[model samples]
Structure formats: C-alpha cells, structure tokens
Target: MNQAGMISTSVSTTTMISGSHLFNISGHSITKELPAGKCIMSSPFVVGGYQWAIMYYPNGLNSYDQPGIAFTLELQSEGSGVEARLEFCLVDSHGRPSDIHKASSFCEFGYVSCNRGFSGFITHEELEESWYLRNDSFVVKCTVGILDSSVVEASGCGTPGNANDTHQAEHLPPSDLHEQLRKLLESGEGADVEFNVDGQIFSAHRCILAARSPVFHAQFFGPIGEKNFHNIEVEDMEAVVFKVLLQYLYTDVLPDLNEFGSIQIKETSASAIMAQHLLAAADRYSIERLKMICEEKLLGTISIDTVATTLALAEQHGCGRLNEACIEFLSRGGNLKEVMDTDGFGHLMLSCPSMFNLILANINDPNVLRDLVIRFSKTSIKS
Candidate 1:
C-alpha cells in the first residue's frame, strides 16, 4: 500500500441537567375523597429551562374506576419532542426515596401533550399499608433528567499525511440494494412463484422468499417441495396481508400500515389493525424480524379500548412482552374496568381464560376485582 488517506471528523457531546421536586400531601386521607380523573398539582418548577409539575391523583387518573393512586409529571410549558427521563417514588421518613415503590419512565413529549407518569404509582392498599405514608401524610419525589446534545468541532491531523503532495479521494455512494429489491418486487419482472390468496394472485421469486423466511425456504426446497412449486395456495390470510408479507420478504423494510385502508378494525387505527393481521402472518411464516416489528407497532397502540383485544392477541401469539405490557396497562387507574366494558374484553375472557391469573398477579387490590365482577354482572343484567 502507498499511503493511507486522512479525513477530518467532528465529534458530538451531550450534557444532562437533572433536578428533583417533592410534592407533599399534607392530608393524604382527605385527598382520597377526590374522585378519579381529578388531580392536585404541585407548584410548577423549572429544570433545564423547561417548566414541569407533578400531578397527584389520590384516587386514580384519567378514569372513573378508582383502583389506585396515580402520579404524572406534566410539562407545564408548550414544547414538541422534548425528551426526558422521570423517576417517581415515595419519600421515606428519612426524606430519601423508599425502594418499596418506584416507577421510572422515559418519554418524548409531542405537540398534543406533555404528560408521562405511572397510573398505578402505588395501589391504594399498598400505600396505606406501607411505612412511607407517615402521620397520615406522604411525600412524592420526582427526579427529572433532561439531556442536551451539541456537536463540538475539533481539528486533528490524521494518517500523518504529507502536505507537499496532496491527493483527491473519490467517495462512493451508499448502497441502494433495498430500493432495487423493492423495485423488483413492484415490477414482478422475473417472478418464479405465484400465490393464490383469497382469489387474488401475488407473484414473487422463490429465492428471495426463501432467503427471508424459513417457512418459505422449507416450502420451496425442503420436504414440502414435493407439492406444486409454481402456484401455492395460502389459507386463512387476506390478500392485502399476503401482499404486505411478500413486500417485506423482498425488501427488508415494512411498509406503513396506513398505506392500505382495505381492512379496518373498529375502535382501532388502520395501522393497528394491519399490525395485528401482519403479526399473525409473520408468526405463521416464521419471519421473526417482521413479527417483532409488528409487536412494537402494537405496543404503541395499546389503549383502554384496544388493550383487551391486544391482550388476547398477545396470548394467542405467545408475545411475552406484549402480554406483560397489557397486564401492566390494565393495572393502572380505572383501565381494567374501562376495558371490561368493551366487546373486546368479553372476547378476551371467552378466548383466553388462562390470562386471568396473570392479570390477577399484577393487581395489588383484591377488592377492585370483586367490585369489577359485581359491576360487570349488574351491567350484564341490565343489557
């Protein structure tokens, strides 16, 4: 080799500003009289130039069912995409955070709102029974950490280059293999295999499908190859879902679910519906990466109306993380009762009765379940 080429580079640095605020409930018992969805907020404080406040919901927050005490850190000032990490814990007798109950969360506040906190910071029974609640009062400590990153320019000599003899180096463009593959999938110029899905035919290359999915590989080249190779009949999957599956198999990218409006799940977004169907297809084809992508998308869409159905889906597909998250979401505020009122909740109970034990495990208060069953029975009678 003649000589190595040198190029200057710029480095980035990040600075973190952290501060803690304490909200003390003087008469904790009195605050419990407040209804769910009502909150008492601490005085606004500034940390890293952003104003924030601690919202304390003695009964619960954002719901009519009062299952637990909730706390949320709210950004007082208007800001978009403000990233921060929050830690909420009850202060002990010594003014230090008690390890008994602590919740940590990271959030990127968007334009619509800036609130990130735990709905079940601590269950009512747990808080009343714990030593952290002293003299009929309790103190909640919130630690906020805001990160500020900046790029700092620094000069340095590289490769011990000779100044007298200067040379120009050619730079190569980034690879567009994925784009080319996407184009190939769209064109169907050399498709060797065809799939019949719900009366719709999709053409694809066997080699590309085999490279991406193990199930496809076995079907094309393994023992399953004894069957016809030219035309394959896919079962129980919609034409749209199979098309998206083929697209993912060809290119490593998953298209936005909103692109297609052919199927819509009631009370759920188009993306969520697509993700639900695609997750099942991905699981069937043994496409793990696609399965994970769909899982992550579903995680973001979990809400009171959708959590029950999502939980059922998680149980059916053996998605451990999704299952745990749904259980955790149910344990918060009045979410469980709210979800119980939905049709999906009925379906969940009927389809996955095994999930009851896991749900019971996360619930701190037993009376809530008792009340839920009684209330649900009354609602059933009325219906």
Candidate 2:
C-alpha cells in the first residue's frame, strides 16, 4: 500500500457513512425521498481561513445547543472570484437524510479585508461594521459616532429639562408724600367710595357716619363724604368740635399744634385730637392709603398726651411703629413732665404707669423729676 496515498482502515473505522446512501449505492429499493425537506445542515464547515458555523431559524423549536442547522459556506477563490458560496446537507444518527434544498444558486459572495490582529468582520454600513462576530455570537464594539458625539455636546451645555417660566417685575421709584395725600383726600364720596390719598387710591363700602361731626366726618370719608356733609347740620358747639375732628379725619393729617387750644387730654380726646384712632381704624380695615395718611398725621402731631394714649392703643393692637414713636416722644425731656401735670394726668398715669416709668427713665432733664413730684402732690390734694 502507498501508506501516504491510501485511505487508512483506522480512519474508515472512525468515519463511517450509513443509512440511505449505502442502500441506494447497493441498488436496494427504499420508499420515500429520505424525508429530505425535514433534514437540516449540521455544524462545522471551513472556508478561507475562517470556520463557519450553522445558522438556526430564530423561531426554530430547539435549544441553543440543539440548533436546526442551515449555514452558508464562504471562501476565497483562486481566480474563480474574490469569494465563493457553498451550501450543504446533513443527516442525524437516525436513518433520516437532509433534504437537499437549493445550493449557493441564490447567494451573493463578497470579500472583506480587515487589519491583522483586529479580528472582526466589517460591513459596508457604518452601524453594521461596529459589531464583532465570533463563534456564532455577536457583540457591540464601542466606537465614536455622530449620535454619541452630539449627545455629549448637548450635555456639556445643560440638562435636557430645565427652563424657567416665572418672571419678576421691575422696581419703581418712591413717590411724593404730600402730593399723594392731597390726591387721596380729593377722591369721591358714598357707601362704596373711592379716594386717592398719598399716591394710592382707597375704596370703602357700606360706610355710615358713626358720629355727628361734619368736619370729623369729612376727614373720615375724604372728599366723597366731605361733599355729602353739605346736607348735614349740627349745633354751634358740636359743629365746631366736629370741624376740628373732621380735619383730623380727612387727611390723617392733623391740625397745627396750636389747634389743641382748649381740648381736654383723655384717651378719646387724644385720639380725637390727632385722629390717629381713625388712622388705626383704617389700618385695621386694610386700607393701606388711609393707614399711610394716619401714620403721617401721627408723626406730625405726636405729643406727650397723644403719645400716652397712642402707646396704650398701639400696645393693645400690636402696632409696633406707633409704639416706637410713642416711646421716642416720651424719651424727649419735656413731654413726660407735661403729660403728668395735665388736668387728668392722674387718670392717664394710672392707665399706663409703666409708660410713665419708661418716660422717667428716658428723660434727660433733672427738672422733669421735680415737676413730676409737684404735679403728683397737687393731684393728691385734689383727690
């Protein structure tokens, strides 16, 4: 035997061909076409320098290890072409032979060249070329591309979902105090009345005269109620007092310091004196313009007696500004002594003795103490 050229009996023992092929060559008759269409190709075919594995139907009823084989045989051809395609058929351990379907008749062969050691197949399309196939498995290969680059650029600028919808208003300059007050006083009359005072307009509704003083009512209602006062009447003394009261009411602007000529200094009297109660009432009702007017008037006409009354009212109603002003006025030297010596000083003093002490502690003049002692002695004699 030519040992090198001979087919060894040992090799034939391991690689045996049986079943239908053997029967057909032996001239034996067999029924059926060997169930050809039901047969599938089995794995491991070599072409070029690469080994091709069998492809499986995605919906085939088989496990990953038990593939229903069908694969393309790819090869580099010598002078035949750049590439060639081949097809195959297989048989299982049973006598079932694979149906010999069409071969490479419908397939298109193509060549791919890649850098040595790079180890991957490249396709014409960029997206497809970025995939690696090895041993029948496909994996994504990381590569820079337009999609990732664009996303990185956008992220560098900002996050995807942040836009503000709210906008703030611009600041305005301060207004003229007296001009604003004048305008407020001039605005009209009635239950539902609108008036402009100190740069703001005030609106009041369902209001009535709680006291019969035309001047007092005028200040309370502004020009609107002032106009209505033409139809109202009062006796001489009441009308005079009401006129002074009305002046205090209209502007929260008080009369000159000289106007308190002969009036008594009591809670109602002091409130009536400067009309601060009216301003306070306006503040209580949320009439901003009126409250400003009242505040302005209180600042202009602040006095020892009025401060005493206002301090008490301010403390009761939590009016911090008014309370501060009262403290400031009493802190001045002459005012506290004057308040303690006035006709109803004892009554006023009794209502706010702490305020008196606060005044005494703050007064800078030594004479203020002497005056307070003399005034208390006179009050005791009268009582």
Top lDDT model: 1
Task: Please write out the lDDT profile of model 1 over residues 228-270, one tens digit for every residue.
Answer: 7555788998899998988888778898899966874576578
lDDT of each: 0.79, 0.39
lDDT of 2 by residue, 1-383 (tens): 33343221111112211111111111111211232223222233333334333322221222332222222232223222222223332221233322221122223334432111111112112111111111223321111111111111122221223221111112344556645544444444343444333333344332332333333445556655455423333322322234333344444554553455443434434434545545545444455555565565665556655665666655655565565556555545456767665544575455555555655555556787777767655655665
The whole-model C-alpha lDDT of candidate 1 against the native structure comes to 0.79
Best candidate according to TM-score: 1
Clashes of 1: 0
The candidate 2 region of ten consecutive residues with least summed lDDT is: 141-150
Candidate 2: residue 342 lDDT (0-100): 51
The residue ranges of model 2 lying beyond 4 angstroms of the native Cα positions read 1-274, 283-289, 304-313, 344-347, 373-383
